[model samples]
Target: MNNNSSIDQSYTHLEIKIPLDPSANERLRSAVLSRLHELYGDPLPDAISDRVNAELDIFYNYFYSSLFLTYQKLVNCINGSGLPYYLFSSNGASLICYALGMTLVNPLPAHYRCASCRHTEFSNSADSSDCGLILPEKHCPLCGALMVSDGNDLPIEFFLGLRYDKTPYLALAVPHAMSDDAVSLLERSFSVTRKDPRDYKFPMEEGFIFAYLDIVPTDSDPESEMLWRSSSSAPSASSASLAPYEMTNARVFEYLSRPESFACYLPYRDDVQMIKSLLAADAVSVNNISDLSKICGLINSVNWFGFILPSLKSGAVDYRSTITCREDIFRTLVAHGLDSETSYRVMEMTRKGRAASILADNALRQQLLSHDISEDYLTSLVNIRYLPTRAHALELAMTVYRNASENVQG
Candidate 1:
């Protein structure tokens, strides 16, 4: 267990444990294999799966992703509250509290406890238990007016600062660069990167970054935009001082380079059914019964078969079954770009009526709707499920639709 003394004096311990779900490895592998086969028409050699799995295993074990995923899923589930997408950051949290106080609205459940104070309150009032939140209330008995929540209108900088705080985790930079970028003055520099922090794989711009940033600039902190972090452990540095738009553009550039990053956002719960349907369709496309028979054999076992060469249809295996085979799918959709026909098909197939799909379908539908998405882009998205999530696919569809719509209107 690792404990941090700085944040909580009460002593909070984070535990490390290996995932025992034997099925997770296979499920994850098959997920990847499905993408590879769809993209490249066959499973990658076992060596590649081994490499990717090693990276994935490490990421899967991190608390940040789990926490972020939980927060995202929860916020997406809320109804009719146009609270700008919830974000992580000391100040952003404050902004949310402020908005909650102003609107007398609660985005989270009544039972939700403050991560800092462990206080639970249904509405804004000082009499309520301290939720450890930065801004408890506008006129509360507890921590007073650095009272971040004024209800509703939070300064843009607050949200900007919040995303900046998450940069190290999602941005994955060289230690030397992180130091130069994250720390400005010499006084607190040693405190932030006391250990060999560069050796750790800190996440920066994963799928959530794109899904959220593409919609609400709340998640985006342009380095050029002067911003401040309220934390006392470090000297204040303005985001604008760091660079033009700061490191935001740089990180975004990095994320867009990897097609797989975009691909990862496609896994809405109902997407599994859509993919299964597509696979069945593709299976029929092969035409040669004997060839189809061989491909199915490989596809069915591709999740664990180790290596595959569509040219050879044979390979070695180092792990249990979970080989992915979705390369062709990505290649096809990405190549065609997002289109109206594909988007419509995707929305139709992944909708609520699908009984065979996962229960998480509603979440996926909500995510898609959040992005102002249309049908054609949805089709392109059904192909990129490696980093699949409810928000990412919908965002992509919306972006494509918005662009096309604007072009036509112009």
Candidate 2:
């Protein structure tokens, strides 16, 4: 109805329409703003508020009318079960989604937040890396309390795109035991009339549910539901205790560094063996959660492992400073004085396997060089056929962490 070209015109022509509550947007806004204030203190930072409001506006104006009811239904079903789960991919990296309890990942830039004084300070300068975990130890200036360092430095654009027009999709991973029940609930809720019973179809696998709602036609007004996918896997006993939006756990990272722990998440035997070999040979070390996250990204990518493994094994490049995920490229460019937009463009291109073309552009090349971007870095980007997001990696790492912790306790 807004006449935005970015919205799929086909959606407008559909005969079905789900009646949305008039107060839904207002209620959502209130909840999100309350969560923001709770996380960042009263009178939220102008920058944070502006960014959140802008995203909210996009959702309200373009997406909420179509997806809100379905999302609400999905959330209700998932939360009703009391089972631990995580939203995967860029959707998981949204601050609004995190605040809405729709995701576990927090998309704020690397920062330190004090629990006592509610003081928050971003640490993403040229000198400091984008990873807060590696930042120098510091105490809150106001209360002298040690501040908690967290955040994955993911931009909202990663999920919503530059124009905020991308059709948002949700991919969730829930416990295997309740997957069938969740799917049945969704089917009943959406009045699902059709389904594709396929297993391990590319991204879909056993315990995966992909459903689209086609409401029964009626005499008055027809209704339809938004399409979404859910994946279920066997979770470790310890995973059930994970608190929502909890990111920092030193014990988890310690467990993740062990070679055998890689088996927890890596599905293939060979991939797990490769990672174990790397760890055994000291080819790569998992010093923190971020490091384990990089390993996740590398293993899932098309060419990154084969491309970078040699250098790592030969001690030519330290695994700690190497690029594994798209965030690494974005952080590197920003650290070299490139604006965030430009940095994101480069990162996006690289993820889409266009890094070679990026280096071929003379103007962009000279600009990058002027900012002291190394040719080696650009070359490294060329090898990135596909890159996983830090959000997904962290989610997987956290899952492994929870499982390992439970095993240790037992």
Candidate 3:
């Protein structure tokens, strides 16, 4: 256990234990292999074997033993305590997670149970009518549970790949308030990194997962924004003047470099990560156009972010209001020679989803039209950016409610 006092006292005792150097990855490797053998039965299928090895390789190579260990400990903690949680993040797409009982979502070749007969398992594709996910799926003649499409249809590559890294969001769904005894146990079991002492609230960009929990109190000092922690981890001496949650140019660029898995509003805190990641990188591409593939495909995870602009009146950015505004730094991106396709899609999401007339300057639109950008091509970009950040919140809440109910039953 880390003997250092937690930055936040709310998480004083909890510590996560993991090996120092897991280069060998043998212990985890053996554990996962044994679990897979038990789940899929003996000599695993080729497709399954390939997928397992691929994910494990990444996990091992990155030295993400703590991540897996965290999941294992978290699940054990919740299940042993009889709490209910539904895993729904991209990390939930891993078969290893499901086998470990950390998730109920499955990522594998889609399979369906026959509704009428109940016993028939089909390897073949099921049309929309036969799909259980869409409706009263083909009613299993023999049973109902078998006819449903695997509860998840997401690509595993979306969650983790050889080229990627992720910060796991194990949002706690505490159903209700904990008894003092339960609270003690919970505190002794895990730790939360503190946001900053100035505000005591988490950076809203990170979605304030514990905003409702009152695990930390709000810092009421008015000059708190100008304050700085003198720790080595603090941004920089020059940035010491910025508010705890406010962004500096360096901070913005650094965060943009590695897009977070959850959309955080931390230049604000507590806003959904999905919402934050959407727009920043798409616009950043305007300047770094030559690295378009790396910027768009690899570096930035989502294209749904806007620049964290300064507040005009007070000259202080309010983290909460900054995120809710639809205005992005698109115009600025256009000023830097942003091309049509990326700009048009990003701009479409703002100001009522229209591309040209509303968000884009007419001069930029004319430049695009001069290049013969088509209306069809402009509209072809799909809006599939719906991720369930709220569901994570609710899952933790449900767990709390369940725990409360169990206590009542007991």
Q: Best TM-score goes to which candidate? A: 2
Q: TM-score each candidate.
A: 0.18, 0.72, 0.43
In angstroms, how far off is 297's CA in candidate 1?
Answer: 45
Which residue pairs collide in model 2, if any?
none
**For model 1, what is the alpha-carbon lDDT of residue 231?**
15
lDDT of candidate 1 over 43-145, digit per residue (tens) = 4444333434543454344322333332233333221221212121222222122222211111221122222332323344443221112232333234222
**Pick by lDDT: 1 or 2, better one:** 2
lDDT of 2 by residue, 18-97 (tens): 44456667877887889888878988877678878877887777536335445656665656654344444455567777
Residue ranges of candidate 1 with Cα displaced over 4 Å: 1-27, 45-51, 60-406
TM-score of 3: 0.43
> How many clashes in candidate 2?
0
Highest lDDT model number: 2
lDDT score at residue 332, model 3, on the 0-100 scale: 28
Q: Give the Cα RMSD of candidate 1.
A: 24.1
Instruction: Provide backbone clash counts, one per model.
Output: 70, 0, 51
lDDT at residue 361 of model 2 (Cα atoms): 88
Q: After superposition, how far is residue 176 of candidate 2 from its true place, in Å?
A: 8.2
* lDDT against the true structure, each candidate: 0.26, 0.60, 0.36
